[model samples]
Target: MKSVSYAGLTFETADEIADALLQLAAALGVNERSETVDIPVVEQNGDLSSVQLVIGPASQFISKPVTSPYNEPASAEVVERLTYRTRLLDLPRAAAISDSEIGRLDFDSPA
Candidate 1:
């Protein structure tokens, strides 16, 4: 289990979810973007809840390991979604240049 502190409030979630959330936040920060996401978390009373987090370039988070007996919230879908979004944010969206295109450009260039 991991405790993620954001906006002065702490929420507990699975280790993978916490890690994925951090990664997504970094990606969003690098891109100077923001997003609202709902993450499955365990409340202090051991009840399941989905907390909405608004993360962006200025967002700050603190994640730490925590010992909890309650079964880590099953949030594979959340983790997968976060991972996918993080990867999308990290990808460079420029068009790909083929080897032939590069060769043509090289030949057309002045010596």
Candidate 2:
């Protein structure tokens, strides 16, 4: 388990979930974007609950190790979605142009 501090509150959740959430937050920040996410958490008495967070360029998060006996929350789908969104914001790369294409461009002019 991990303790994730966001907004003004701290919540306990699975290690992987916390790590992925932080990573997604960073990616969004780099792209100057924001997203709302629902994270599953374990309450103090070991009850299951969730927290809604708005993460963006200005959002801050803190995650630390915590000991818990309960099983990690089932959140693989959430992780995958976060990863996909992060990938969508990847820096643009220049497209590769072939020598033949370059030659065509040089000769193709409107008369």
Candidate 3:
């Protein structure tokens, strides 16, 4: 198993190191192509060791959208209409009714 050690703490796997790096990136709001993490280690005799971790070329969570011929971009109006339709569909039937119409409901009557 690959591992990295610094400041008396040892990360015993690449996954662990990657997770830590991701957390660090999130905390720092790092959305750039790449980022470096420097881990400083100091020994009892006052010797220092620097461990560098190169994060990445922007993980998928922060990566920019790639343009492709297969994907045609939609106009702002179209996007807004689609979003509005989706939100309308997501609402409960009762909530979708207008407030003025809601007062006309016959709660004492059975369906």
Candidate 4:
């Protein structure tokens, strides 16, 4: 049987994970839609062994208020200006040295 684990919880199958997320959302007074939840999943058959943190669907455990710099208009404007000014550096040309030139150069030269 496939299994997924997060925080201190373990869930077997996608349905169980969905139900658990719904319960968690309900506990936190947040409405969870069946179609909206995007749970991190990995499928494997046999005894429950591997475990990982669920990222997308589980937001109930986040104690701190999530903030984005882009959420603010000023920050977004600054980011946009910086991004617009950014330019890709031109590729440097490779040195074209012949075997005769290699022999002429010192084998041990200090930088």
Q: Point to the candidate with the largest TM-score.
A: 1
Query: Is candidate 2 or 3 superior in TM-score?
Result: 2
Itemize residue pairs with steric clashes in candidate 3: none
- Residue-wise C-alpha lDDT for candidate 3, range 46-88, written one tens digit per residue: 3544456554444332222232223222234433443443344
Alpha-carbon lDDT, every model: 0.92, 0.87, 0.41, 0.37
Off by over 4 Å in 4: 1-17, 29-43, 50-111
Candidate 3 global CA lDDT score: 0.41
Worst 10 residues of 4 by lDDT: 64-73
Residue ranges of candidate 3 with Cα displaced over 4 Å: 1-23, 27-32, 43-46, 56-111
Q: What's the best-to-worst order under lDDT?
A: 1, 2, 3, 4
What's the C-alpha lDDT at position 10 in model 4? 48
* TM-score ranking, best first: 1, 2, 3, 4
Query: Can you write out model 4's per-residue Cα lDDT over 53-110, one digit (the tens) per residue?
Result: 3333344432212222221112233234323322111233378999999888986887
Highest lDDT against the true fold, candidate: 1
lDDT of 2 by residue, 1-111 (tens): 899998889999988889889998999898888988888999988889999989999989999998888877877887887778778779695789998898768456675
